[model samples]
Every structure is written in structure tokens, then in C-alpha cells.
Target: MTLPTITATRYVLPLREGGSLPGVVEGNDLGTYVIKFHGAGQGPKALVAEIIVGELFRRLGLRVPELKLIQLDPAIGKSEPDFEIQELLIRSAGLNLAVDFLPGSFGYDGSAGNPGDQAMARILWLDAFVANVDRSWRNTNLLVWHKNLWLIDHGAALYFHHSWMPAEKFATLPYDASDHVFSIATPDVPGVDAELAAAITPELLTEVIGLVPNEWLEDGDRERYLDYLTARLDKRSAWLPGGAR
Candidate 1:
């Protein structure tokens, strides 16, 4: 599936919830989005992780907002007085990530009802597979819109890429699911594992990886990422919940 690319037409405001300073912006497509800056301290690797993991979530039949590559123009925000944000905007004046804005969405409080065991299981399984450390009770990274739970902010996943290490080095690292927000929900992890293991074939990962912009990748970085994830996928049953198969 090809993702639509849009250019930022305007910067609306800043989202202060996190250190990256993702902001609201209008796209050339006439849609509003939450744009993650490429110049953020976490840098483009975070955007790469977001696209790959978020696409994985979508392919696994989970709820995540549509992602797009947003081309930012620094001139659009020249009037903003904040030197820090201005500097970030100027530095990030190129391709960034834009998440479709879900207006009126509220943080998930577990009130709308469970996201269903199977779906929740898939989520936990994906997080484990990617070694994501962001989802917890305090900051669920989940949103509730129209009574449906939507996953967001996956920049923290695929963290192994930050070091550009060999994929095999961390293949067997166990995921600590105890702190996962859905850990207590009794997710059917084994079933989810079997389902995803079959679904996330090499072809699927390639398709997901293709969604990332080329500039985000360094020399051989893409292959290393692909290798790392494939290695992790091969060992899912070991690191996933309920221990090794």
C-alpha cells in the first residue's frame, strides 16, 4: 500500500505532551495532521520507527491513524517567536511525519470497554516483537475516538536501529511485559503470536519498510533494520509472553 505524501501548508500549534514537540499543521491535501519534526533530538530514526511499527499495527488489524510524509517549509512558521521551536522548524524544513488528526479524541481511560482480547493481544505481541518501551499505564499512547482505541506515538519502537548494531546481537532479548498497560488484561498472547508470526512474513516487512523515506536511512541502515526485525520475528515465541515455545 502506498502512503500519500503531502506538504505542510501551515503550522497551527505545538503539542507539549512530549519532548519531541510534534505540532498541528495543515497539509496541502487540505487535511489537518500532527507533524513530527525530523530535527527533533530523537532525529529521523524516530520517524522511521513510527512508520514501520505503525504500519505493522495497521497490517495486524489494529487501530492506528493514517500516516503520511509531510514536506515542511520553514517560511510557514517564520512568525513564531519561540527561538527553540523556530530553530526546530528551520532545521526540519524537509520531509517529516504527519499523523491524521483525530479531533475530539480523548486519552483512553479503559471506559469505552476493552479493545477485545485478540486485538489487545496483537498489540502486546507487536510491542514485544519491536522491543517498544513506551506503552505503560501512565502514558498509554492510546487514544479514544468514536469509542474506538487508536494507537499512536510509536517513535520509541525499533530502538535497536539507534546504535546501528548487527541484527543478530539482540535477537534473543526478552521483552518485559510486566509494565505494559495491557499486561493485566490477560491477552491471548500465544494465539496472537501464532497469528502474527505467520502474517509478518519477509514480504510484509519489506512492504512496511518501503513506507519509510530514503533520507531517513543511512548506508546499509535499511538492510540492517530489515535484518534486525526479521531476526526478532524468528525468535518471537521466545521473547513473547508465556516464555519460549
Candidate 2:
């Protein structure tokens, strides 16, 4: 599926809370988005993870903001006082990853608007499947908007791709969910695993990964992701939080 592309008309403000220095921007579509720049500290790989994992989450029927390929023009940041942000905008003056901005969203406090046990189980299971290490109490990476939980900031997921090691080597690695934001109590992990794991078929993975822009992936990287995720799903017994059912 091709993600909708929009040109950024203006850079509104920087979200300094993010290590990579993402920012709010107004799009030609007249929509607001949180733009994740390619020039960020983590580079384009983080944007790749964001698209792959975010789209996968959406396919799994989870709440995630609509993602788009935003065309950024560095001239939009010319008037910005921050030299650092100006430099970043200059370097990222091309296609970048962005998500629909939630107008009144608040950081999830882990209590309000709880999505119930089953949904929480699904969320935890997904993180384990992708080997995501960012969704912890320290940085929930979750937002509560309009009384619902919305997942975000998946740039830290699929850490195995950061190296040249064989993807199969990371397939059997265990995920430690003890630090997960929703790890307070055990959810019906096996039940959720049974339901969700079947949904991650190779076809679905291909579609999800296809949503990533071609420039984001290098040669063979596409097949490598497919193979890694497929293998990981097959070897879930080693990584599922509560062990396979």
C-alpha cells in the first residue's frame, strides 16, 4: 500500500522531548503531522523501523496515527532561531516519515483509558514479536487521545537491523518484557499470541513492508526483513513473553 504523500508547508515547532528532534509541521493537505526527519541522530534506519512497525501495528487492528510520506523543504526552517534545528531541516529536505498529529493527546499514565487486558496482551505480544525495546515505563511511547490508547514512536524497534549479523541469529533471541509499560501483571499472553501470531502471514508482512518507501531500503534488505520476521514468528516459543501456548 502506498502511503499518502504531502508537502510540508511550514515547520511549526520542535518536539524536543524526542532524542531525534522530530517536529510539528503543517502539510499541504491542510493536516498537521509529527515529522520524523531523515537527518535525525538515528538516521534513516529509524524512519524505516517506524514505517515497518507502525504499519504492522495498524494491520493488527491497533490504534496508530495515520502515517504519511512528507516532503520537507529546508527553506521552511530558515526563520527558525535554533541553529541545530535549521541544520537538521536542511539535511532532511526530502521525503520523511510523518504521523497525523493528535491535537489534544496526553502521554499515557498507564491507568486512564486502559484498553483492557486483551488489547494490552496484543500490544505486549507485538512488541515481543518485533523485538521492540522502547515501550517501557520510563518511556511508554504511548498516547491517550479521546479516551483511547494510540501506539507511537516505533523507531527503536527491529534493532537487529542495525548490524550486519545474520538475521537468523537474532530470530531466537528472547525479549525481556519485565520492563514493559504494561508489564505490571501477566495478561493472557498465550491466548493473544494464538490469535495474533496467525495474522502475521508472509503475505501480510510483504504488504506491510511494501508500504516503506523504496529509498528507505537497500538491496536485499527487503527480503532480509521478510525472512527475519517470518523466522521470528515461527520461533516465538523462544521469545513470547509467557512462553508459547
How does each model score on TM-score? 0.96, 0.97
What would the TM-score be for candidate 1 when compared with the true structure?
0.96
Predicted candidate 2 versus true structure: per-residue lDDT over 1-245, tens digit per residue: 59999999989999998679999999999999999999898888998899899999999899999999999887887777899999899999899998999999998986785678888888999998998999988899999999989999999999888894576677889989899987743457888887898899999999988888888789988898999999999888988888777
lDDT of 1: 0.87
For TM-score, the strongest prediction is 2
Residue 91 lDDT in candidate 1: 91
The sequence of per-residue lDDT tens digits that candidate 1 reaches over residues 108-140 is: 868778887877777888898999999998899
Q: Residue 144 in candidate 1 has what lDDT?
A: 96
* Residues forming the 10-long window of minimal summed lDDT in candidate 2: 182-191
